[model samples]
Target: MAFAANTALISSPTLFTPSKFSSSRLYLSVPYKTTKFQLYCKPSSSLPLTSLFCLRKKEKSVLSALSDDFPAVLDEIEGNSGWDVAVEGEEGEGGFVVQPPEEAKVYVGNLPFDVDNGRLGQLFGQAGVVELAEVIYDRITGRSRGFGFVTMATVEEAEKAVELFSRYDMDGRFLTVNIAAPRGSQPERAPREPGHRIYVGNLAWSVDTGRLEELFSEHGAIVSVRVVSDRETGRSRGFGFVEMSTESEMNDAISSLDGEILDGRPIKVNAALERQTRGRF
Candidate 1:
């Protein structure tokens, strides 16, 4: 089959033969309008295969007209593999809050304390469109913890952002960006020093301080267990805290059951830091 500079050719299995002349070249004999012609040379090379195909000037014009549709064909090829090619500023409505598509990449780690959505968008948008930026905050003080997420619009952009900004510095601190691992993929955290409380979530509706103590007491002596509940309703909110006698025991407990699904729901178990109480409520 003959092809132009930007043209691609598809050949039937029997009609295509590997070239004995060069590894990158192929030979094809095509029958068109009662005449047969032999084609040779590399279709991928800079020279167009027209030199061998005997296409007249008029026929070349038709081929040129067909070339206009190549991008759309290529777009279809890209679409089949979980990629969507989009032009700049044309992404649909809704800002960063939208969940990044499964193919989208995310970044994590320390960020500037004052960083906002716009700044984050500008920083990551350089690599690719930034779909979202969020800074986790302390519940009480509402202060940024110098960490946040930046979700890129596409996998390629996400990968590019990670490569370009993983160690880029802002406000005198180095940033950490990478393909965000799926949630709960992080390794179990080592237990904190003694006296640290463990945050427990996804408790069964019937769970309470006594049940929590009973469950966690197997690992070590339980200092205390408190199931946080709604102040007005007195119903369990499905979270609690447990203080172990030693950090080693806490480590064992967390390692054994941090994400263990119990009673149809996966539990979130982690070392809980001391709660900062800023003035009594």
Candidate 2:
């Protein structure tokens, strides 16, 4: 069977024998791109197969014409999958996309602060050719985020890297290595809104960002934690900001954790304010 376009291919496409569909020709009234779908067609004895099948824009036109003339082709194709052709730039909705088993990218998590982009690629090179390595960094602090991504030449190399370096100790931290999810695959986080930031007063002098995260994490997903410090002294100023993912989480932390005893100090939690003297209460 002759295909209209090369890019329009089905998943596990079958090569139809020339003896079967020697004159099989398909005409899609669509403009540029033809979408993917399986074509199940067999010649009928009573009414011979037409040399060409044309699918049109109007539903009634195609249905009425095919039902009257080429019933077999119309019934099988439409019943299995509908015509989802695309214009020059428009993308068609649901159809089987032929893709490889796994992506060539690997996620490397819990990395040490010392690891750089080059070193990460060198480490993954033991498995195969490392195409690219990237260590994520905190944009504001300009510090290593302790996690990065490594891209190999092929999916097989990525799988090999995962087996060799998963839980592999670097310095002291055991690495978390696995195939990375495709871009835009994960659900996007909700945007932060007003009242999402929480202010905690009377915090212990030792209470820092990490410590504050451990305490309030049980309430909801946290955006960031900052234990405010004096300009001169590096010590925590007994107050900080805990940015939650949403306003409800901020309210919950305030109601549940306010006055909670920590390091012999009862902490106060409230909505963060923009005013400088807001923490006076």
Candidate 3:
């Protein structure tokens, strides 16, 4: 994700706090011009008196206006700055926006080839409500992609799910969890039909298209093998796709090669599903 440019202006303390006091409070004897200054008082006197002074007009200087009430006042600052602090929950409490539970949508990545929907749900269901769990499979091959998605009822539950199952070990493999993006937005593609292409990752750095084809050909006939290469470096990306002559071959290749040791490296295979053509399709 790319972040927008941020420019912050730091003001000297004197610029923000009230510089002029009531003339009545200004006395010749007073070292400072003002005396009997009516400093802003916090509802709770237990707070330090220093917090009553408001210093610096710029948004960054609001830190000088430190008080229990500071959060409330900062909330009133209208504009982009409000959103920056608000999203961070700077108030030290749950902010106005409620975060969905952790289990809302579970991202199950780095999976072993054999994991399926039932196993994925059973694993996460241990933590909280699992509305649904599915191991993405190649449509043509019907093989596990080593990753899946799970959905919980709420954001809080979703968060809990991630915390509880992010590193969950099942069948001797550890899983990774992130708040799942909406359906169809995952990196793994669905299985394409005969002559359909899909991505393969975690390949041995030394493996090439011909080597991959030769290795997977035992399961089925490979029509084409394309190893994605870096544009700048012009080197194999350690991943690529194999287009099979038939859907059965695709599935056979996925089941046989996925998670199987190839040249001493474990490979992950899944169907390259169609890319979502439209939003929410």
CA lDDT of each candidate?
A: 0.61, 0.67, 0.59
Once fitted onto the true fold, the runs of candidate 3 whose alpha carbons sit more than 4 angstroms away are 1-103, 183-281
List model 3 lDDT by residue over 88-206, tens digit each. Answer: 22243344434444437777875766678888888787777777888897554465655788887677777888888775655444566888766556566546434455567888878
For model 3 the local lDDT of residue 256 reads 73
Model 2 weakest lDDT span, ten residues long? 59-68
TM value for model 1: 0.32
Q: State residue 223's C-alpha deviation in candidate 3, in Å.
A: 30
Which 10 consecutive residues of model 3 have the lowest summed lDDT? 27-36
Model 2 C-alpha lDDT per residue in residues 1-281, reported as the tens digit of each score:
34444223232222222343323443233322232344433333222223223332343232222223344555544453433333221123333432333488999986777699999999999999888899998765676767999988889999999999987867644687889988778945345335478889998898876788789988987655667767565567889887776778788999999999988899998888755334654
lDDT of candidate 1 over 41-98, digit per residue (tens)? 2323343223232211122222222234445543543444333222211134332234
Q: Pick the candidate with the highest TM-score.
A: 2
TM-score of each: 0.32, 0.35, 0.33
Best candidate, lDDT: 2
